[model samples]
Target: MMADDIISSFPDEILCHILSFLPTKHVVATSVLSKRWKFLWRSLPFFDFHYDGDLFDYDRNNEAYSHFLHSVDSFLLSRDRDEPLHRFRLRSDSTYGHPVSIQRWITPAVSGSVRHLDLCLDWGFVMPSVVFSCKTLVVLKLTFIRVENTFSVDLPLLKILHLNNISSPEGLDLSQLLSGCPNLEDLEVKGFISTTKGKFITLPKLVRASILEDLLPLEVVKDVEVLFLDSKYQQILDFDFQNLVRLELILQLSKDWLGVLEVLEHCPKLQTLLICIYKSSFDTFLAGHEEVVWSYPQSVPACISSHLKTCSLKYYSGSIDEIQFASYIMGNAKYLRIMKICIDSESHFTFGEKLHMERELSSCMKSSDTCTLSFEYSS
Candidate 1:
């Protein structure tokens, strides 16, 4: 097919898919490609206005940033506000030069039309003073950004919310967010690029959640499918995951594995459990805590998922604590079948010692039927 003819034959949907992978700068530059491509980028269902200083860092005093911001504003302004946006992402590291700078795009993209909203501003500017009551939003991701007092973005139709590195999310209350999002499903608060030092936040209606760093707690949320905890704090978690199915615990062993176990008591059907217990770099935790044994519940609640058949552990060195924990699950998981222990290379276990682990696990199963315990290593 001729180049121009082939471009003309391509469907708008296909064109949008091709454009989504490129940088927004290139997407906009398509306007200069030809008349056929002028409005194609605008028809895209998703907009990721991500600014990478590493790629196009303009001098703070230069006209490039302002010009770029204006171009974004123009595109949003031209779009029909009523048109529902599927995904909208905006992020930067510089303090947004002006408060109004964010509103120029946020105000239009919001308004009960967006289904997936990702609003990230990094360290750039303070957020706009606007309450986005998105009635049709399904997934909402809010990253590092500051907001003035009295701010709320209601997502009545929201299901998944991934909050990463919230800066002074003090004014944002979990109760209001929960009550507003009556249909929320998954909530993940990852402190990847940002950290929190104040009161932890707790939300409502979420079924799966990850609490990392110093994030706040959820006063209430139920029917959870998964739970992940990664933090440096030593506080014992005291929440009840009544119907949780999968649990992932990642933290330094020095912190305390039992604190993580305490959180699992409420789970009635926890099927898959992955414990990445950093073995005190593979020493101090096992030897240091061997005498301090835990007094656990007599019966590990299997109601949440009596169907649990597989288990995996990382950083496993056949430590007494590690084996004891795994044995507790084997005893309670009446239908347990396979348990895989992956010992991290950073561990102190010898090749023969690891082989010994496999032999010991052979007899660890509770039932007459045999369960496989495969011990592996990480590079």
Candidate 2:
């Protein structure tokens, strides 16, 4: 007899590749397509499981929640033990669930030599330690999770790592985690951190790093080439960033412009600079003194005079302080090639006001004769 379906004739590897694009639940549902497909999902190299609990309350719909848990558990248990997982992602938006279930679900994938792992949940829970020492893990992202430095982390091949709102116990230093990621090249960290003083690790391969708030010590990230800082911790910028090339800063409207100039003074080799100013609730209380008065520095920063090539100002309000700050950079940056001014929609500048603002900044005596200035508004 002829084959019932030509698709079933495809090798298991090919069929699994086609099914990998579908959701984990959908992949399991495909078993009814044919007897040959019954065990096909077991050999899949990746799994993506997502549960959006915002649709219903878990307390009132225990049956649905239980069914979700059971379904996930059964699918994982039935997966081929010898098959290596290329990637695994589990995201739960539920405000409540069994934390132990997370550990149980991840253990098998870690043991299966998963290369990439991503876990995002609405609540915090301690992560399984087995994930820390996974030899095959290359990328790891954790959000709303607690990581304990209770065990040694030896991710020799890990290149990218993101830790968002990761809570750890007091004196649990981050150096313990960085020391193990010897080959890590890119890292992003958010939230606050608590650690004992004098504990710092240097990653010779790290070239890119993004930090939000007071998440880590400056000493650990000083050698990065491309750095992004989004916090009010101006003290962190007090250090010399000798290797920094591209820098981005998110500052509040109430912050001192002098502080930003002070930062530029330290990055001697910086070539690109982006500054974004955001309004804060504290601006209301400091209304009279909210605007920063820009003063021309006695000596130009080394970066502005030599290495700086591009500068951008975002959320530009048509305030005198903003105009002065833009003009100061335009006047001093000898090698600046591009200067972008992005207006804030909330400013509601009239056509004439915008033209006037443009004219004022365009007339500045720029040291770089080839510099191009452009203005933009939110679309």
Candidate 3:
């Protein structure tokens, strides 16, 4: 069959499914394709409109956006509650005169049947309260967006929440938000660096969390594998996670060694542990200083995980304190099968540092003859 024939022969449901992935502008434009496609856009439950101003023509941007939402609202308003939104995404760089205009345009369709809502507006104003606590929403991604005050959202069915650069200055208690979302599964919290006071997002049911906030994320996500973000030292609350298996701790700065060691003491069954220590913040200092003042842990915690088998440490420096920490871990990791250390090549450590590091290697070999330690150095 010819291409046109195949396209024309497709079912209405199939056509709607295909149109769901396109932008609202393109979906609305399909009305002029043929009489059959005139009403095909309305049946499309999925609406994805990600507009980047650089690519699209600037002159007609506002007009194009206005028509798109009007069409979506008119279509949804014509439908019933039994027909809820399957997915709705609004990611744009379009600078509307007022931020509420964007909310005013899209609020109706969101009420219809949106299962997923992903909103990211950089230069826009605050979003309406209805967007935060949508009932039918199962997955929500909010970035550079602030929720309105004087309202409490109850997202009883929200399963996944990914928030970045979000803040509530007007006493927007985060514990209340998490209290409502009992079924939350995956949480990714990233905070604004310029924030003066600490911000917290509490979740009781988060199974997996990716934390990039300055403040320690203390939650009761028990029996789940935890992956920590890059930090020099962080003091976090302890949870009873006896069944924990995997852990990824990224240490880039040398702020508080004592706190981090304390955290390691609790993970009893952390089989696979990846430690990434970055040098971006200390590059200039490393060159000027003769001996690096590593924030040595005053005392190593008594907690040791006999089940830890695999470990990876990045940004490994051949320093006395570094070796000491390594020695302690290597000696204690009785069941360790493989250990990998990532070293920088440009680093010309002083003679004393090299000797200290060698002592750690010898001690490790003597203690655990069966353990395997491999060093990956980059020159």
Candidate 4:
């Protein structure tokens, strides 16, 4: 009959849904509202717990830290066993020397069959083994953690997995981790450094992947249909992608042009291609290498002759290698519908040189009669 009573009189399921949108701390605090709202948060499917303070200060704030730990324990203890958890997120900058406490907090989420699990901890805490075998998990994200190679993973329904700044021991077998997820589609691994020798990582059903690492392994790129690669390593020409449809590459300008061309020759089904060129401080180091001679391919790749439709070159500087590559694609891409080039602002070429370069590209013998070319200067 009144505004206050309207929300309080909501059905139990609706009240839990509303509380699921709030942070775990705020949801717990709502117990003080009234007797009817006392246990409503216990059935909420989502829980997010974040502690932003320094863990080293636990001695000075022992009472506060103890209270926070007790609150987490109480919250998990109060959850309804019959209700399934949809998402669980816990982030702590410092573990405060109590890895066991963190483990205890996560055990219930795993047992409850949480669909999405996100855990971020600064200290190198060994994750519980139950996480590796979470069959109900659809998404899993871990940050600043270490994964051992001995554990077994059995995530049958997992579709998305993100591992950031993750480290592994000397004998860690990453292939074991990938093989467990049969239906995984999207995977992102950034700042991952393997201490041991390389392992062959395979994902047969993978549709998209982003790998940003110091050493980009060829095995990880083999089966992906769409890939985004940003790496310091330049030895990726040896790998082949037969089913690849789209590719986005971010690389330093000092990369070997011959190697890049070798990679392009391997993709047979590439329909869309984007290359982002960046200026690196190691230009002098790159200059020491032998120059790449402009030798046109005897026969154009199958992708260029039949499949390629959209091609973009960003930060184009009209260098010899850039011009040759662009000209080759323009001349050979029979199905090309759009070819867009963005000139670099800090390019070495003059205004007249740029105009000449554009005219040269426009006059190239295009195999695709309906192909259109567009040029613009980088802002």
Candidate 5:
């Protein structure tokens, strides 16, 4: 007869499904609504526990932290073991300062066959080894966690993996982890701090990947179709990506025109190319790079002549080397459909400088009759 009674009269399975979309804390708080909801949350397939610094009062934060920890333990302990955990997420600010307790909280989810696990922990926390061997995990994301080399990882069904701000006790052997994932499709590794040399081990089914790293040697995976790289490393002469269809390169100040050309010569199938030049100083970094000393290749790469369709250049300053590289692409890319040049808004360029750059790029002889050139200022 009442609205609340009408909604509660629905099937228990439907109510559980509705509660799955809510946070675990809210789901658990519903226990006081009615007798039917008292134990309904225990059978939920999804569990997400997040604790922020402001969630507890500074004066009595310890009591709030203890309650949060106890709530997580009780939730996991009360879960029916036979029911599969569809997803489990835990993000904490280290209020308790106990790493062993975090491991204990994660064990039951793994045993219950959690399909998705997202963990964001404070520093000094090493993930339990049981997570490495989670075969039922379809998606796993870890942030600010240390990965040890001794632990064996065998995520057979993992499809998407994101590791941000990850560290290693010993140098992390990425090859071991990549070899175990047979179905990995999308991978993103960002801000990875390692004492040993970092490597990007390739997998056959990996279609998209992004890596933002320091001056580390990159072993580019040839099988990745779409790749984004933001690196400080200058040694890119050995990069060989034959199957790359789309590429976005965020360059450092150390990268010169020759370095860009060297990478373009290797990607034979690259269709969409986006280059964002990151300038940190007013000094001409590309100067004194012997721009004219190096002989240009006699013929253009196959990708430029046939495969490359769209090319976008961000932070384009009217430098001699940049003009040369842009001219080369416009002159050689026979199949190019659109070429967009985005000028750096931060750089103070005169009206004459902007007009000259636009005229220079517009006059360049394009091999493709259908090619269109446009210019814009970066937003």
Candidate 6:
């Protein structure tokens, strides 16, 4: 059979499915192949727009940026409006996006029943409120954008939502947004959370949450099974994590070491625990001049004695306080099966010092006979 005959043998649906796997740029380039394929890309249910050049120097590359914007507008507007949009992903570092143009692109996607929408733009303008009310949206991710407080959010079917560096000077009340998304399952928020008088709301379906906000209430994530918390938070661990099975903490050495133990005290069913301690400039200075005291807890937490199974410590400096903390866990965790310590070779400790620290950790009492200790070094 001839090549064109073979190509035209498949139905348009099959051809469109085959074309959807390629990048939209490559897919659009297929338009010149033949009349049958000229508008084949227009029927695709997915739209992905990614600017490929040096987006940092916008002034020097204005023409290219403008061309990219124009291409995005053409691709989005020329698509089959009757087809349901499954996903729309646009990533650009250029901040030249006008609010009207943004609305023009998103309004159709929302109207066409878009399910997943991801926009990672450096544009400083507030997003169109039409996105917040998407009823068919299952996933939404926005970065480097400011969300206004007046937008009424009603994403009833949204399951996974990620908001990175989204701000509102008037203090965006998360409770107001979350109250609308009743079926949300996975959530991640990283940015400044201004004060709001709204009461804490509970999400029964929420399973995993990673929070890097400054002032989020504990009630918002009280029911999550897996949780990640950063050091930037205030009063983050003030409530109990009754359902948390796995926990990850990113902490700085400058904070109170006792707070670590305080967090362990609340997770009664925790099985996997990972802690990464980072050294800041101020921490390095303090480590050089002063000794950080690690006051051992009077009693082992419930999880350590019964449920805790695996633990990881990253950037293990083998300092007096760190060793004390490690020794405490090694000596007490009755169910601990594995403990890994990641050490930095560029740290102040010498080869012999690291060996000594390992020996010290090895000599500690292990409540579980199957427990093993391992060390990894990174330059």
TM-score of each model, paired residue for residue: 0.71, 0.82, 0.68, 0.70, 0.74, 0.86
Q: Tell me, what's the RMSD of every candidate?
A: 5.5, 4.2, 6.5, 5.7, 5.1, 3.5
Task: Tell me which of candidates 5 and 6 scores higher on TM-score.
Answer: 6
Measured by C-alpha RMSD in angstroms, how accurate is candidate 4?
A: 5.7
lDDT of each: 0.65, 0.81, 0.65, 0.78, 0.79, 0.82
Residue-level lDDT tens digits of model 4 in 233-346:
555466679878998887675545555656778888899988887766665466556545578767777888889999998987656677778888888898999999998776
Model 6: number of clashes? 0
Local accuracy of candidate 1 as per-residue lDDT tens digits, 1-379: 7887787678888888788787676788888877888777666677777654433545653455576687777777665455456778776655435557676667666654667777777555555545346677788788876654434546667788787765544555544445566667887866533332233334455678787755354444445677786736445446666667787878575646566555555565777778776644455634646443566665555441366677788877666667777777666666777777888877666778878887777667564155666777876
lDDT score, residue 110, model 1?
A: 67
Per-residue lDDT of candidate 3, residues 234-323 (tens digit)? 445556455457766776556334555666667666777777666565655665466544554544433343676777777787655566
Highest TM-score scorer: 6
Per-prediction count of colliding residue pairs?
A: 16, 0, 4, 0, 0, 0
Q: Can you tell me which runs of candidate 1 are displaced by over 4 Å?
A: 1-10, 21-23, 26-38, 55-85, 93-100, 151-153, 190-205, 213-219, 230-242, 251-262, 278-297, 303-305, 344-370, 375-379
What's the CA error at residue 213 for candidate 6, in Å? 2.3
Off by over 4 Å in 5: 1-42, 51-82, 93-98, 149-151, 193-202, 213-220, 230-240, 282-296, 315-320, 342-379
lDDT of 5: 0.79
Residue 205, model 1: lDDT of 58
The 10-residue segment with the lowest total lDDT in model 2: 191-200
Report the C-alpha lDDT of model 2 over 1-379, residue by residue, as the tens digit.
3564877898887888888788899999988888898888888889788887745555655666677788888887888868778889988877677778888878878876788999997545677778888889999998887766546778999999988877776434667777778899999988746474435677788899998767567767888999998747646465788899999998776556777888888899999999887876666566667566666778888998898899988987657787887888888888999999988766767999899988989998888988999998753
Model 2 stretches astray by more than 4 angstroms: 1-41, 55-67, 169-171, 234-240, 285-290, 344-359, 377-379
Q: Which candidate number maximizes lDDT?
A: 6
| Lowest-sum lDDT 10-residue window in model 6 | 192-201
The order of the candidates by TM-score, greatest first, is: 6, 2, 5, 1, 4, 3
lDDT measured at residue 287 in model 1 versus the true structure, 0 to 100: 67
